[model samples]
Target: MKDLKDLTAIKLKAYTPVKSIRTSWNVPISDFARLTHNPIRAIVEGLKIVPNPDKQLIALSIGDPTTFGNLKPAPEVVEAVRRVIEDGSSNGYGPSNGFLEAREAVAEYVAHQGAVTPNDVILCSGCSCSLDLCISALAGAGQNILVPKPGFSIYRTLAEGFGVECRYYDLMPEQNWEVDLSQLETLIDGNTAALIITNPSNPCGSVFSKSHLKAIINIAEKHFLPIIADEIYEHFVFPGYEFHSVSSLSEKVPVLSCGGLTKRFLVPGWRMGWIIIHDRDNHFRDVRKGLANLSARILGANTMVQGALPDILRNTPTAFYDDLVSTLYRHAEIAYKSIKQIRGLRPIMPGGAMYMMIGIEIERYPEYETDLDFVQALIAEQSVFCLPGQCFEYPNYMRIVLTVPEEMITEACKRLTEFCEKHYKMDDRIILQQQNGLLARMNQY
Candidate 1:
């Protein structure tokens, strides 16, 4: 028996040394598919195998406020949900567009942005789902939508999945992340369906100025395209900046404004969001009908949440909102200052939103090859997680969410500082090479 066991162990070791499972299997795969799942989550999952002994893992990757379980939703909002459950009438499927009251509630909430009515509103599970409906309805196969670079990945993912081309336009980081209107105009053609822009821009975190917004609207009008406004981060701007509803600003081109209770209200779990059509000239008659058709297929946002929408929109105290904005402002400043202090990282101080895009001086860290590699190494060495810029179609940069607790953010920054100090190098040649490489990538993109 002992001799047999030894022989078995020898055979197992020999088998391990040889490559196993090399069979060709025909599996169905879609050419249009892209990993649209949160790339931030993907990074965190990949780093789970790396052992970290010195520091506890501090994840600032996800933008979910509820993840920490500290930031509470409004008392009024909670009461509304409680009342919804007690009433028990909201359990059934809502209207295909949304509950009438909920649609009317959303329409009134953003009524400041021109005239909006219940007929102009369509609800969905979340802002993301709302986007999916909008883009899918607007663009068919072989059509294209112009998206902002260093923006959310979902735009590309959703468009590609729907067999629509993803056209990217650059945002000037030096100019408070405003759109390069010239570049934007050049990307427009007959097949272009719409222009999508995120105010209080994601990844960059720079809010569009009123002038910038007008310029974008003008460009959209000139090219005869509608606007898809991702204003989920609306009203989260800091003291110096103000949130402008694109629908409120545009008079000619129709604006499909998307927003939810996720960011400002801190009720992401409710999964309630809406799209309000602002067609001053009724340019989106067909588009609105298409949106209705799309909404019918998916039903609508949570009926119970829809029941609470009235209170969530109207009754949440103004003080709660002030406090929320104050909290975000403080954290953004802290993150900005911390990244500024770090030797090899250059961050564009965000004026809005809960993110700051920090640029990695690749030449300063020769040990790492790319931003993705740098982020993976940071996770392995310090157990700190942040999203790489490549996930947003840019490289050598990282997007950090400032929604976490102050102490955790500070600790993560400390770990990042130490990581950079440990891997710091001085090489000008590497910078030129990286610049050339980035140029090549941009050209290809």
Candidate 2:
């Protein structure tokens, strides 16, 4: 044997690279872990990566309202945008807070909810951007924010990226997906900065009742945390349910009410959304300043969307909104009926929005180990592409978009039932093993 030091040197030299790269970049990506788990993007990419050629893909993957033929913006709304472009009104830079008229329109719109005014509004690109701004403005790194579970993933994503802690409270499915107030209270602490509420919720489509909204306001008031109400689906109520804005519920708690022209007006690509600082007694000046600073950093939302907003708000016919709601109600009815007949799937009838969640009896499917496995198998065999419940941070369920054509809903449900029949058998041991494995994975995380 060689000398001990010489032997160590020889071992190190054996692993030399063919080439070397040099750089001064020392900071690691702070948000890399959170960014990698964007389910929508991951699912889209997964579809592209699959080598199989015979996949019958019916994408109920994302919540884009325009895919089904709903109302496009009115002709007058389009003309307003065209006029702004032709006149070069939006060709140059605009105020960081947004155009005065656009902000005024947002203010007036929020005013209709009860107590908000134009002075409270700040326009941003969309609700996503508004949420980011609000999170950044109000909370710094290592602080905590409360979010609803089986809810919008963006709130968790944004909070994590900013190094803010995200604490989740349950939206109990048994109780029509209402926010669990006791859970909310337990999740809040001294470092908590804000609480988020999504009216006409995205995944569940459950609208909060007036009594529930008031109770939420009381919770916020007791905690001294500002409320971030995402109302993008505000007016998309079904036949029997009515939409309530959080600003309408209280004059006591400070609310950062966010809404967009995307879902209700059917113009998502337009990219115009607003954040209104609803402080009835002038208590949120610091929060307002923080928002202003954030807006200043990013500049304003799109000028073209901003320019047309006044007309979009004022001139869009009431008939258009009424018809849109009626169409959605009909689609919801069709989808609900279809889902009800399917074996091993349970759907709570949605009251608002264009999506519904269906609980999957994992025990019913012997081959499925989790909701993701069930969804993947469904896509491979039946060509149906519903979102797995785990994608929305809820396991043992899947979400279906009701925006598909009425005929497609019937066909999709039929395929789903057949798929379940083909794969599932009433085998107790297999299900217990799968559940044990799933529970182990959950506990590990």
Candidate 3:
């Protein structure tokens, strides 16, 4: 053998980039992998979109609040995270459920959920993960879960991925997206495992009142079903409305309430969320253990964030949330007012959350076969993209995110007005109505 230095040089000189080998082997994919799909991603990515070169693209399709950079976390939140990192205590693995202190912080933060404690809380990677754990723990193969139509698509994505069936109950948009109680009752059967209620709903953004929530719980009480409450948008009610957690109203029903710092904290990537088990009669005693077992699969959420939880939950000023909600409320008004003025579109005003759904009269725009076609054409011409209703299993409508900057919201509305005017086919009845309105305006002058 050569000397040590000479041997090292020889080894370095002998190194070569390995090339990938071509193999004839074909591995079969599992049914689970093949069957699991995200409808939003599939529909959005599958579109052959070509935006207009003259106008810049304004994407109102994403749900993230920080997408526009107009919103940001408070200094206290940042400082807390920094302190956690500097202390170096959070670098190691935490308990599978979560750090007791972190869980305690979450419990205190959501006290409105009724007597929440560290043991009642299980931290997850995010609200989506919290939801996943709840769904998987509550339901299994060949079982069914009832979800709202025109609801967030994640429930379907998670439920179906685990071989559980998702049965949809109708939400009457005209009734501020309230669940059709009669229809909801009919969907439940022997195989139904749980009922999913997304208050301050994602697509509709309609917050159900306390009475409505109580009515919903009554159904669950009667059916002997557990509830998976997606309250990630908790306390985000508009000025005129209030948000009531499904868990808070239930006396007998067990609720796995999912929430996190994703939206309200302006930190989606932080991946901090928790499930508050509110089982009044100890219905979720086994589920508490089940969630603990499920959490073990991912270990836990980010350790540093968990370390920062106490400060983040308690120290962040209330003013920050008030300002954020004010901005979103203003943006909601701008979109709703603008879209309401546009012909062939009926804008449903949302009580809270960061989205607005506008109904499309496809008959008035006969050139397009569906809402997808209308949105694609809007993207092609106006460079403004909104999510088609098909993503939520609701047709003849589209959803627009309200977290974009104000100027962009104004510009988007202008572009939408122009696009709708160009494509909207006014029938004789509409033309006559417009003429009459013009005469009334002229008479007033």
Candidate 4:
């Protein structure tokens, strides 16, 4: 009749509910572990658990560009790495903030935004890691952080795991995914520590205009919250639009801008990214110290990549970027036009990044229950893969990457179109009744 509390911490393993007890030294998983796990990876794994030999799945799920296997790093960057291997200095430990040379290079690259120097840059494994560091440093247990509703889920994942709550602010899809200022102001309270924004956003893919960027800055300044600008897609804007850094517009508020070599350099595996401290007024002195303390525990980015970064930043030809961005522009056009051609699916033409957010009309396609059901059924039938809006915490929508080669994208769209055609329905009532009944009928080839 003795309770489990009577046992010591070490002996408490015997109180485990399962058949087996910890006979030796054992550890239990933390509640935070489940929250911290990447939902994207889990979804991908869930979809792949069962192997269908007949159906060929075309992946547009993961955002890593290198998965295409066609895009390669600049020759100079490869050569620089080769040289680093020969020299063997970068093979050893370097500064925690980053190699001074690498920081200087990132400083020079981002200097166009504002006055920047090597002292302002802190490098990490990648933009994701930099974001993790920033979010963890800024907010502690029980505090709240404002994030975009359809934003990258990692912010929420990490925030929740760290015991910080995440509050979502709506982005107006009708107005090209701009933040709803009124909704944003309403979400703020004393517990809110920082506001996270992704420019050239993921999932939403809409780049903020200079005016909008200034408005965001003004709001942050008014509320005294530092901005975590996720600028990983910096300079990835298409023909008509330009990427503007929020930090460039003002000096009153602090900006911890995170970016990486992943998208722009076309080498995500390089794992090199940095945080640029844009505190022109020295307002973030304590924040910078917190970042320094956290970064010190992790050391820095890949030294070989760090060694190559300077050459990669300075020597990469202008034509290289021009061609890459232009190609992305064309792909975005193809995706936008193709999505428009399809009934019941409305797509917002992206200004930058490589994604387009497509709004799904569930009433039009009553066969599927939600965006997740739509994509799952699409993959099951047509073998076309896309992340549902649920992955980004915004349901009734789906996100597709347009940066894949044009022919591949065209063909994927063709398959997506076929999938829609296969399940097309004029009447929602019949489709509703047929959810289980007609689903099999539609799946029949």
Sorting all predicted structures by TM-score, with the top scorer first, yields 3, 4, 1, 2
Alpha carbon deviation, residue 23, candidate 4 (Å): 7.0
- Candidate 4 vs. truth: CA RMSD? 8.3
Model 4, residue 214: distance off in Å is 1.3
Q: Per-residue lDDT for 1-445 in model 2, tens only?
A: 4699898888878987655555766655656465435555564455422322564556676588778564466677788888888888787778888988888888787676775566678899887888888888888887999888898888877777677887888999999999889888999899998999998998999999999999988999987888888888998898778888888778788888888888878788888888888787878888888888889887888998888888889888898888777877887888788777877888888999988999998988878788888888787777888888876779998898877766777778778888887876766886799999999999999
Please provide TM-scores, in order, for all candidate models, with all chains considered together.
Answer: 0.87, 0.86, 0.92, 0.89
User: Which residue pairs clash within candidate 3?
Assistant: none
Tell me which residue pairs clash in candidate 2. Answer: none
Best by TM-score: 3
* Global lDDT of model 2: 0.82
Give lDDT tens digits, candidate 4, residues 376-416.
Answer: 88877777788888888899998988666678788888988
Instruction: Rank candidates by lDDT, best first.
Output: 3, 1, 4, 2
Scored by lDDT, the top model is 3
Task: Estimate the Cα RMSD of every predicted model relative to the unseen true structure.
Answer: 13.9, 12.1, 8.7, 8.3
Residue 128 alpha-carbon offset, candidate 1, angstroms: 0.7
lDDT of 1 by residue, 1-445 (tens): 9999999999999887765564887565676554345544455466544637777888777878778865788899899999999999799998888989988898888887889899999999989889999998899888999999988988876887777888999998778788888998999989999999899888888888888899899988887899999999988889988888898888799899999888888888778888888887878899888998899887777899998888889999999988888887898888888879888889998888888898898878888888888988888899988888888888999888888888888888888889888998867787799999999999997
